[model samples]
Target chain A: MNSEIVAIDDWNVPHKKSDGVRNRKDYLERLLKTERNMKDDAEPLVSWGFHHYFHGELTRQDLDLISKDRPILIIHRSFHEFIMNSRALSLFNITEDDLNHLSKEEKKFASLEEGHFSERGLIAVMPKVMKYLAAPQRLITGLQITENYFQENGITLIANPGSMYNPSIQKVKNYVFGDEDTPFKSLFIPSALYMLEHTDISNLLKTTEDHLSWGEGKVGFLPKHIKLFTDGAMYSQNMVLRDGYLDGHQGAWLMENDIFREAFKLYWDAGYQIHVHQNGDSGLDRLLDVLDENMKRNPREDHRTTVVHFGYSAFDQIDRMKKLGVIVSANPYYVSVLSDLYSREGVGYERSQQMVRLGDVDRAKIILSLHSDMPMAPASPLVLMHAAINRINYAHEVAGPNQRISALTALKGVTLNSAYVLGIENDYGSISPGKYANLTVLSDNPLSIDPLKIDKINVEATIVEGRPFK
Target chain B: MKNFIFVIALISFNVFSLCSNDRILVAKELVTLDDLYQDANAVYIKGNKFHSIGSKEDLIKKFPNIPVDHLYKDSVIVPGFIEHHVTSTASCNNNEF
Candidate 1:
């Protein structure tokens, strides 16, 4: 892998620092000039930002200079949608009529000439984009950069909840753990959805079997653990709901109902702990339906089928989740980031405020943990705890008042409950004897600190396996 | 010209000074968060592990000749906090490997 090829690549620095870009005009000005040194010319221009706040800010004309030569793909901050330039449209060779059918006139962010592609349109373009990103050097560098950032944040263990069966990940695993001496551990659980898309079930099962004990240094794979997405993201106004969004748009299921049930069964029967990525209430409904069916048929006890992201739910769902033995690994930062925005654009005030629903989950006695889902949110545990305890959004307003959990619960959401989600509770999470002495040495106790000040606490050091990481 | 009592006190100080090099630390409030001694004014460290935690007077009575090494009279100590969910893996673009 050549460093020169990577440093000048379009994917390099696709996201300009958010702080530097004050407004839409400033963003476009930066995008127009951003370029990369070519590596055989098949790559597209990728301008990235991390939030939906940049959604409508980009118009067709704003992409004039950037799209003139090579294809341009502007991945909005949401990761749910993307807008492509006219040149990008040529890759798929689709016209305006082809895209308009993806959404209604009122919601038509995707058009042929403007080349704004999202939802179905974005999904269509993903394969082509991934091909370029799949290049060996790009993947390695991306993981390396990600590893460095996480280490700086005092993270000692990382779980890739939804990963694809890329063999290069093995090389990455070797480089990170074997040669690079990464300070933390990495675990990968192949995305069941991606496996179904690329390979047959048998091969997927075989590959998983081989990687069951794949541990080198700190990198390892959880055998038989699978990830599936039930529905789309709420931030993009694309999550399925019982009543649907205020905009009158209906969210689509990621997998067909029958297919989801069958896929879940194959893994569930094989003794795999299934983790589903579900955001909307309707998505959750589909999951609950499957859980009930699985319970009646197989009747396994203490099976901790987990709901990852567990984004939105009605009050009734909490009791159901507990009864089904479905624990949650939620991104509390979602409420902090998306609640206010969703309130105005999609779900409305009542549902928007209660996105993560930590308090309800606590009252129902469901095991819950918080995750950064990084680059989705920073991989800082304290930051996640802050969002859980405070439930404050970007507007500095507490989005959900009663939904806030106590500092102890919030702290456990990051530590004890997180270990439970990973099924490493016996070895990690608390200060028990014989467990690895991996401690996140903080300047203040999160349990005793001011709720608002939790995120600001400084990390003094990280002790990994009884030795200081540094 | 000193009184006999002052001479006796000097002799006691010399006796206390004989036992030294015992690592001791004092804080405004030392919280072990341990089941046994919940709170203390000072702590003794044997190597890198906690040896004993108690008031300065009790520790002096227990280990008679130990001298205070470091005093953090304003700081609080508790068990090192553990972050349960933080990971070292870079999962960008929705954990797509």
Candidate 2:
């Protein structure tokens, strides 16, 4: 049988011979013996890779052997969940008694024998592992790689909505500014409200302000906008919702209620454009509450408080958004990838179909733009344009026919609406005099061409400041 | 002698038309993207700026004696597209084809 293996290590097995899963057991057995021999050396378990999707391919016995070598943490593809080997639990100072004492929900995700974890279990161990990967050198190398990739795709601007937490602003600023050959501009927004306890806000603010001219015009720090994550991702089944999941698993909020409110007030009082990463209806409810409260207290106009990754929301929420003047930077590509599976496994068919309700948002006259959410979707604006226009899924079926928009509106979603999201509409959204001479030259105008062929239209050149970069 | 005189009259008219207007561009359709005269079939360009846009006959009549640059008569013209959200983030780095 033919199958695809995304990524696997060849530490012990002959990778050339392991062409298909028929030989997968032999591959696992070889790795198991290597682990057994390694344990005999009395060395700490540094790292080992395994695929969660390859459950049946490898046996429990094989996993047990590998776990004996050292403490092991196995993260799920979604990154919200993880599993630990027997040694890994001890390494993290978690005991059998502690596992048994966990709340029933936590216990459900924790398995003592298999060392499997999800949701709560993963969150418990993530902080410990993140430190290893949060080194500045590692981050700069990764950014350099991604930056080059963006240049090849004709991208000239990058926005980091939150300039805090795992990656330090100074490190990113230094790396980008230090390198004169940096391909595109970087826009950073100060966030990290959750780190208020550990962070010196005054110092962070000073440093953030200094980063405004970090790249001498190429890198800009937007002090007007702040980022907040309201809920978890939809694919991870962690997005909070008013109605529970089909399997009866209640989703979670990334920030506590009080913490979210405090963060909102700090940014709102400061007159910053607040961008929230809200995914589910319940998450929207929380955000709407804050927005309503902010409006009542201060009564600002065109606040442009945006909801990012707005993956799932109710029909009523769109109207609420319009009244509150909340705009959306939604990812319809999420609908294309997850709507079908989410329909069956997560939310019911109805709610799943309603994911990324661009149609309702459009009818409400809400300012809607498309976002790749980068890591979540491909950062091709044309692909985002195509997805918004066709609303096609993995099976090539229209996920939501009503949600499909015209090619013109879809083009605006990527350009004008996107500029609106960044509050840079006056400078870069449209082709008007005095605006930046930025143009994405296409072989065919999306406005007058076949909607299905929008993605196929080759980008001949990207013009920035009247000069073309092919 | 009559045929020669008629040919001279047509050539003189063409030269006068060429010298009167800066340049006239004719196309299958020109979308000015202006609120007025959005669906124009021709455009009149004086120097580097757009002078006027209308149907081919209207443009010709507006600049009755002008040089015409006929191109893309089978194609369409539109305002250049402005792509807004070309993000350079983790999304561009993952699952690229």
By DockQ, who's the top model here?
1
RMSD of each: 9.1, 10.6
The residue-by-residue lDDT of candidate 2 on A1-470, one tens digit each, is 00012123221121212222213565456455545666345543332223433333232234556766555444332445555556666666654654554566566655656556555554444455444333455445545656554554445556667544433534554465345456555666655443443455445444445545544446666667777778776656789989888779778666668878877877677787888888899999999999899899988887899988888888888878999999988887777767766777668778877789898888888888887655455566777788888888755688878887777677677766777788877666554434554445455666767888877766554544433355
Task: State the number of backbone clashes in model 1.
Answer: 5
**DockQ comparisons of all candidates to the true complex:** 0.11, 0.08
Worst 10 residues of 2 chain B by lDDT: B88-97
Assess chain B of each prediction and give its TM-score.
0.58, 0.58
Candidate 2's displacement at residue A290, Å, is 1.6
In candidate 1, list every pair of residues with a backbone clash. Answer: A50-A77, A51-A77, A157-B87, A158-B87, A415-B84
lDDT of the structure predicted as candidate 1: 0.65
Q: What is the TM-score of each candidate against the true structure?
A: 0.78, 0.70
Query: Which parts of model 2 are misplaced by more than 4 Å?
Result: A1-128, A134-138, A166-180, A200-217, B1-97
lDDT of 1 by residue, A191-243 (tens): 76666666676676675666665556666787767887788765566679998
Candidate 1: list runs displaced more than 4 Å. A1-17, A20-23, A33-45, A50-54, A57-62, A86-125, A177-180, A201-204, A213-215, B1-97
- CA displacement after TM-score superposition, residue A268 of candidate 1 (Å): 1.6
lDDT of 2 at A50: 36
